[model samples]
Target: MQKKLVCNTLKVQWRTAKLLIFAQNLTMGTIMAKESYSAVLITQGEHRFYQLAMPSDVLSSCTFVSTRDEDPDKGFQRLLDKKRAKEIATYIDSGHGTIPTSIILSAQEICGLEYDSRNKTISFEVLSGSFLILDGQHRVFGFKLAETKIRVPVIIYDGLSRRDESRLFIDINSKQRGVPSELLLDIKKQADYENSEEQLFREVFDKMNGDPNSPLFGRLSPSKRVKSKISRVTFNAALKSIYPALTSRTPGEIQEILSEYLASVRDQIIRNGGDENILLNSITFRAIVSFFIHAARRVKDRFGPEYTIDNFDVVLGPLFDNIQIAKLSGTSQSKILDYLEKHFKGEFQL
Candidate 1:
């Protein structure tokens, strides 16, 4: 069998070589094999083979059908516009001759269409197999509208899986300009595998940085862009370094503390005519929080876990009161925090 195969390959190559030589000499016409010839050659062995081919003119014999009869509650799938659909149909009709077969195949795969024999037409139902819309959905939809006969390339899978389909859909739509941040956040919440606070923070960070729809998507904040400047890490480290007497707290407890600190800062900013620059640009808020945490730890060590900064009017109360005065001095945020820490530590009395 091997010898026979080798002989057959050599014969085919010799024939091809002879044809090339003849074509070179003639420089007029070339020999081409039809689908029948290809089919015959492919099925030469005992193995059964199926060859399906659609002519250029007969390509658009398939019709599209909606899988959902009722209104889709998901709100992910969008309805096609009559004007845009007509434009697409026109483009498909005019550009069919110019567009490459590869692009057409790509369109078919994205739109999810397949050929059916019993129906004697191509249908989206036949292409109901699981496939992702990699790129160019609008163009494909346009083609569907324009041409009566259109050919598209498709990948067929056993069943349509929602998880797999949603992932692909997200990836495709994610590239569109001006995607809303709320939509991305909702998607992240739904798609997130980890439910822990730390995991949630990490996931939010990752998604915000990576997804196009996130407010912090590609833009670099001073803290986010520079590794050494991330306020959260720097503030946490400063607290730990200054107050070695402090112990670790649970994620929930830490979150509550941070939330309260942020709320206080926001309240102060709002009272000051809502100066966004002062609120966001100043590192004082972060530094002050770190100092407060250190002060709280010192109080905790001297007293107990219940001894919070809220109970210390002399320390905590005056620090919040003095923030505006310190900020007005044009002093460095770190310096102001350090001064406050020193005062609380008894180097000087406030």
Candidate 2:
């Protein structure tokens, strides 16, 4: 009697779960529950196999699988505003059932998605009986904003395991080709939702290129796909290495000084009939800045702490006296900055 009761309970649960999946299909106007069924067994001769009959709309339900860590409906609401939701609605309405697989799968595969005007909708299938969002919470929110109805694709699996789902989610995200550092930073920021600083560094390091030996290992590189660790350590180290002469000043003060100096250099470059864009693009500006900081320090150590940028014209010459500044090509920016700072004996003028 107890076994029969337990079997009945299982049956009720299965039915309820099926009803929910079917209801989603009906809401999208793709198929009616009667037309679609799950766990139906087909017998061909002596062979018997269970089959899940999904409609065209079922396949089209491209909405991402919710990660289960958050409530999809509520999470969507939080990530998207009303205005963007309307836009997504319009995109869905125009598509007449055809949606970009890339928009849907890319996010699923890449762990994130960007809003593209060209692509109106992104959809994915449910995993582990739930919809997990690999990416584009904002786009989903935007679609909701537009008040457009979206039918997302989903792959339904029975008895889906959490570990399996997470693995799939991570695998899809990590394999995205040609991801940018900025994008990785954004992902890291999202993954570490609590905004812990250490997690930020780890994610940044994971996304960067080149071996551990690369000077840019913990620093932002010129590559589009790489980023610096940007921890307090790197941040302070960068400032100290660049302007050792300014050691007396606090980190905050050093940042202010560097910001002002860079701004001045930018202005000067523009005024001198130099192509501001080209100057910024070349290593010359960085090299010159390094030279200036180091040279200023050398002057101060030899003379006194009274040295200033005005006196830089005279002091900078000896700092570059033995080294060929012109030949200092292809050197790492950080190295050049460090060498200059050390050589100058911590003497520099803003």
Candidate 3:
């Protein structure tokens, strides 16, 4: 039988944690070439791992999905000084800092991996758009920009939910004494004072952030810190979108209704493989929730005193049935206004 494979298999170890790593013998310094490789894919409780090597050949293809504070000028991970990367590169080229001491990285959706674990090595092609750099954006991009190639190690956590990826990033960088992580934590606290709906929004955001079943879990920036993709500003804005409708609703009541709605949207997004895109943004979330509170009054009145998923979905089903996230993402302001006014024609009033 001709053994079918994509890339070669190799052995890897880390103090009793052994991995049958899949690797390639692609020529060094040819990072830009369209090359293919293989990986050892492992599945663990809603998470995937693709243990592989780090080189320009691989890093060049990987995307950087950063949780860094994005500045329009400096962009994500603004603290990543090119001078620092240059220093590292110079040290490497000088043959002194040959081994990267504590470089840590995490990635999502390794196209270079298989879905499940069967104890068999899987082959993966190293191609552009194969992965995302959840952490270590500088070192990875630094090496790529440095005009030199060095083989570093990487932990490619394939098929990771955004929350898990964020957690891993926090774990790696925080333990490394990353100043940014500490600052983010500090900022997380100060965010509450900066806003009017901070109390209600924080409660809702915290529940969603902590709940594993929640789609927004791990994806919300609670500290206004450099964690997760979504920000507290977005969350606060979402509340403000529904602020007028929230006259009598407590935070817990709001949490229950939003949780169910988010779970549905999240599942739909994941099912469609739309997780990578900025699909669940402030506009869509705010608009949908606003529409729900505006339109679900019949259900609320009939059900009496409390809101429920059934009540939300009665209106949500008809409204959201017409709403496709991929199609509606980044929708224009006029369209959003039109959408809100359309279904809310006969909504229950506060």
Off by over 4 Å in 2: 1-130, 134-138, 146-159, 179-316, 321-350
Candidate with more favorable, higher TM-score: 2 or 3? 3
Top candidate on TM-score is 3
Residues 1-350, candidate 1, lDDT per residue (tens digit)?
A: 99999999999999999988988755532322211111111232332222334332322222232222233643244554567756766766775433343211222243344444454343332222212333334445555556456545432222335544444456546755654443343355456633454243443344434556432344323233243223333333334443333335543444444444444444444555454334333365456545556655654675575543244433354444544543522447677677766655556554
What is the Cα root-mean-square deviation between model 3 and the actual structure?
21.7
lDDT of 2 by residue, 63-103 (tens): 44353346653222133345664655566667643443322
List candidate 3 stretches off by more than 4 Å: 1-196, 224-228, 264-279, 323-327, 343-350
Candidate 2 lowest-lDDT run of ten: 105-114
In terms of lDDT, the best-performing candidate is 3
Please give the ranking of all candidate structures by lDDT, highest first, separated by commas.
3, 1, 2
Position 246, candidate 3: lDDT = 66
- Full-model lDDT for every candidate: 0.43, 0.43, 0.56
Ranking of all predicted structures according to TM-score, beginning with the best and ending with the worst: 3, 1, 2
**Candidate 1: regions farther than 4 A off:** 1-175, 178-183, 198-292, 307-309, 317-350
Q: By TM-score, how accurate is candidate 3?
A: 0.38
TM-score of 1: 0.29
